[model samples]
Target: MNKLSDEKPNTSGVLSAAARDARMTFGDKAKDQLKEAIEIVNATAKGLGISVGSTATAMLDIHSVAFGSGSISLHDETGIPLRGMGTGSKRLLTAGLHKEASKSKSIALIDEIETGLEPHRIVRFLKSLGSKDAEPTMQVFATSHSPIALQELSFNQVFIVRHDKPGGKTSVLAAPSDAQGALRATSSSFLAKSVLVCEGKTEIGFVRGIDLFRVEVRDKESVDAAGVSLLDCDGGSETRPFERAASFQALGYRVAVFIDNDRPIPEAEATAFVERGGALFHWAEGQSIEDAIICSATGSIVLAILEAAERLNPDDFDLLDSKIKSASGGKLNFEDAKSFAEMDCLSSEQKAWIAKAAGGKKGWFKDIGRMEALAREVVGPRFEDFDEPFKKVLKSIIMWATR
Candidate 1:
């Protein structure tokens, strides 16, 4: 079977039928192939538990494997194209299968788990290695050069495969037990996505909050619950963060560096560094992630509520005005303040008016933990969650900014 498989394979990049036919392959066919791949991997690696299953292909346009000029994609059973899957989603599914097999005391194995994934998505893949719901009681092993994957997996879990120089024998090198040491050594080896450089705990706190609010976020529940590892590369200056990002990028992450706009280096220079060397995503102009939240009544919270109300009901500017007056201290325009001062500037009547217009008490400031929450309710019921809904807004912003 191996010989036949190798013989039939196209060695060169002549664009094999698999790539061309991938677009036409239906879900059932893809599922069978995936299942076969998983089974074969399982057979090769004993002890480590592995399982496989199929998910109903949702949107296939993203997954179609195209050959000619345009790209092709895989399709589902319905002849609909297969959709693209993220590293996180794929890992989740993979972990789920392994979990099920573990429940049945089955052996686990996976050949190439990094297929069809984005670099940013590797964090998710590494996180799934330690899933709590369906953990591999035995062992888990995979072959991947993805730095994100390496960084995300436990040091103990890492095994470097190499050929014995003299004997021509295959050998494996276990990563150092000391995590910091292993990470330091590996940082020089991989290409990281983005390095988040922050001032201190506060900066770390802010970045972490922002990450949570991100639409395509690393799954904290799975990562933390299952003991999946993540690198918290925190530092004060661009020097360390930049250094770490470079090191990790060399090892292989689409590295982005996150730093406060108020850091020592000029904002322009810092931004330029990030743009040129590292990919950095920061808070909206003059606004930090902390400002994203709206308090219930005091401070910037009301301003946030007012902003949401205004955006959703742009036609009712007068209504917004009245609410601003009611909430303001001296009937000031709620939009005047650059920050939360707008809330204090208004009177109670304006506050109540704006809140009432938004959907009454339950309408405006219903949830106050994050500003994204307020932004969503104002936008529409469709955007209930802050991250999912806010991501669309961010994408639009990115497009606009680039243009």
Candidate 2:
């Protein structure tokens, strides 16, 4: 203290050495590295979806410091010390220091990397900790439950650790590469207790709409409240949803898949997935979602759906005239589809033709918005009126979600 009190203290060249260390520490390397790392921080922080400040960097900084023994203050800035910084800033600054130390082949451990940091900040903090590098300069073992952290990292860099209470066994399994696609798209599901892998946007929307329905009308618990996250496979392939769900099973995620029964998955793959504790949910024999809904729905409900389709998208979605006409063998020439729903009730043949037509590439209810509305506003209200086969599958889904 007495030595630092002097304007030009000559305490064994400590001030000069400290100044030199500060320049060495926060000089070129920090400038370049911090510049690159801060760019990531700025980019991720840009879309936090919340108003944090005037800018991402406004509330953030890196100050040069001098190591001082017995002194509470190490930062060169007057009256501001390490303790004065926010917890998130201190954690980030620690990562930066560890990054520099890693050049010396140091080892580091950071538990709960998301603690004291926002989602966007977690991303940049990982960057500072050498996570963005192909290979880290030093070995770092980190544990995080943050979805952003999982999103920023590849499957190869992640491991799922589980402890089974029955046997008191601890297992650490490396995440499969296929799971990375789901991780990138729905990162938050990695933190979910159960994952429902849907075949495409239609299923995802259906699940979301059903959850909303159960919560608002049915007076039941939500799927989200039950720790079930719905994932979209984007209609990848015949086995796409199953393959991804199998990957999740490998990661020890309680996995389930909702798919169309029109295409049969390979028996061997299906058996293996089931053996791995994956739950499979699909429409009845040779039935797609559209077919199942139409088959189970009453004539009036089907009429309502058609009316909504005509009212909402009469031009594009109503182009199903040729499809319906072709399916009906020209027996029911429902021109323009505008006149189809004017009747009191459609026959079984008409219903089948409508369902088949709706399953086409440009089907009316094939899109997420239309499917969501179908589940939430239309069919969900008359849940008790669906046929036994459709009700069975739908009830199974409800049971799994609420369980």
Candidate 3:
């Protein structure tokens, strides 16, 4: 470098006095280059039609570039990086990376396998794990409360842990066979000690309504608090309840069946279920659930129930009237159900026919929500106003729940 500091020209017109005085002694060695750059910039600003009197200034700081790599990252076409990926997507990506990176066998333990995944995605991700061929490639152990995740696994693959308060002991049992569909549909029942396996949505709604009535009017706790959970048989042939009940019983659950009397399950299966400590609850023979409930109602309550059902089925004109008329074999034919109100009253036999029509496939209150509303609005409020036998059957259920 040329040192002409003492004989430097009087170039104060090119720069201010402060700028001239600022460029002093050698700053060791490396800083001399920085000082030269500062002078060059200050000198060039004038030729470039720039003024140096503004608030702008420049300096060098070594510490500022210490962690510069933090700003460096690779991104996808849409400018999203690894940090921008969703948790579920990140997890799947990680699994895929592990699958490709590791050639040797490995063991993986994942907690809450359903975390950050949709139901269908969860199934697909799970199916990707474990053995690829007859010989195992990887082993996986996952914990989850999701029924969808559990449903994809077979019986022996799932283990349930239980605690016995009376004996101060714990037991781990494998899931039971023949219970995949039912167990997955009502997975919460697995946690309960008692399961009242009801036939279809109608029975489920009826029992739910009774539970509500028992709680609201009778001043009792809910069946849920009593460790009793209601299960649906998922509606199949007469043997579905028994098959599911037997499966739950094998899993150490106190099981019961609440079904219609239109078609009885095989006597041998019924006896076997009872012999295995199962409970059976049903209406008198030749009677479905609708028949048993409607035929037992008081005349005023019967009209109230009919009015509620008719109100709920307003879309179908003269619907209940047609069902009632056809159910009675033209003995109770009417232009509209409203005309039935003109009668002094309906006999028990006439109401039974109406009940039969209601239990049909296209009947009123066939849906779970509709049947649930029927119980809550009509049957639940008029609990004692129904026949004694109807009340007795409900009482049996309440006793079992509380016991």
Candidate 4:
């Protein structure tokens, strides 16, 4: 968890005095004071959907001071402090405030939100911010290096601030694609952008993965620039991308569909989808989207893999041989399971070399860490602001591969 310090404490003495007064109060007077304090803090955090432990703790501390006591006693709707005070009273007091926050519609903005909180608490914080009753205008924004915080936000909401000089002026600004425009563009895609429907997560992952790679490899002047959004339809079942596209289109969105050519059902169904104003991409006989990825290696997979490799030790991911051999059910005799499938069939020695380079059983090429590291490196100094460029590259790869 990230440790967040107080916001320079406008006046420590004033805050300390406030705390003293609150701490000295007791009983009915104390309860009333703390309740009002809790309400004030909740109101202050309004419009920001997320809150960190520091914000919560700080507010509680202030309440403690306001009541002039060791702890602020909170009452439930029954007008009784939970469990009737003493020993477990502090804990009950904390719980009471939590219950109130949970029920409140105010958005939370915690500075250094991860500070002093465990993973579970952080997740809870995000959940509270994302509550069903959370006001539509409420949204959370926080700064932290914790993976948990990153996980809490969608890829689009993770903002990167950088310092740059253009036209002799140095300023701090959200990177080009990192701006609110890109975020809103991607976030509200179901209503705004074109929806390219695909079958499964891997398909969605591959497209998004490839697009992010292109954003890193190519420059802005290149064809088909970034800002494209990928939304997973969660398979061809009821919530499939096609269904999502249709729904979004009905609500006034320009939606398109892309599906695999798996046997009778997907192929036949895809044709009908295209006829209904959707776009289609079919995998060849017996080929799934993963295979399509291999087929489009030249324009798609290789670049992404290369980008990943560049970020770390490229020598780490030789899964080509094993994947192919596995795909062939051990019929093919290749040395390593870690070779690049795009590298045209290789000799046993080359495969062995790949396996050797791939090193551990988890193969570097398949590691998400390796991929992200490579993405950060290839995307370079400009990577901090990665949205626009990535979308462009992804679209080009799809267009090039499918073409």
**TM of each candidate vs. truth:** 0.29, 0.75, 0.73, 0.38
TM-score of 3: 0.73
Q: Which portions of model 3 show Cα errors greater than 4 Å?
A: 1-86, 131-136, 183-188, 191-193, 212-220, 224-228, 334-344
lDDT of 3 by residue, 1-403 (tens): 8866677676755454433233222222324544564444434333322334421123212123332434333222233344455676556555554554457898878888878888876775675564233555567878887877766676667777778999999998777777776667777777677999998898888878767776878788888899998898867888888988988887788889998888866788889999999999988787788988888876667677777776778877467777777888888753433355336377767777778877778878786777877887888888888889888887887788889
Give stretches of model 2 more than 4 Å off.
1-86, 116-120, 311-344
Please give the ranking of all candidate structures by TM-score, highest first, separated by commas. Answer: 2, 3, 4, 1
In lDDT terms, which candidate is top? 2
- List, residue by residue over 117-227, the lDDT tens digit for candidate 4: 566655555554453333433455666655565555554455544334465544432323222322233333432245565554445545544455555565332112432
lDDT of 4 at 70: 39
lDDT of 2 by residue, 67-174 (tens): 343322223223233456677877786676566645567777989989889878888788877777877886779998888999999898888888999999999999
What C-alpha lDDT do the candidate models reach, one value each? 0.43, 0.73, 0.70, 0.44
- lDDT score, candidate 2: 0.73
lDDT: which is higher, 3 or 4?
3
**TM-score of candidate 4 versus the correct structure, residues matched by position:** 0.38
lDDT of 1 by residue, 112-158 (tens): 65666666545544444542224455455677756656666666676
By the TM-score metric, which is better: model 1 or model 2?
2
- lDDT at residue 115 of model 1 (Cα atoms): 66
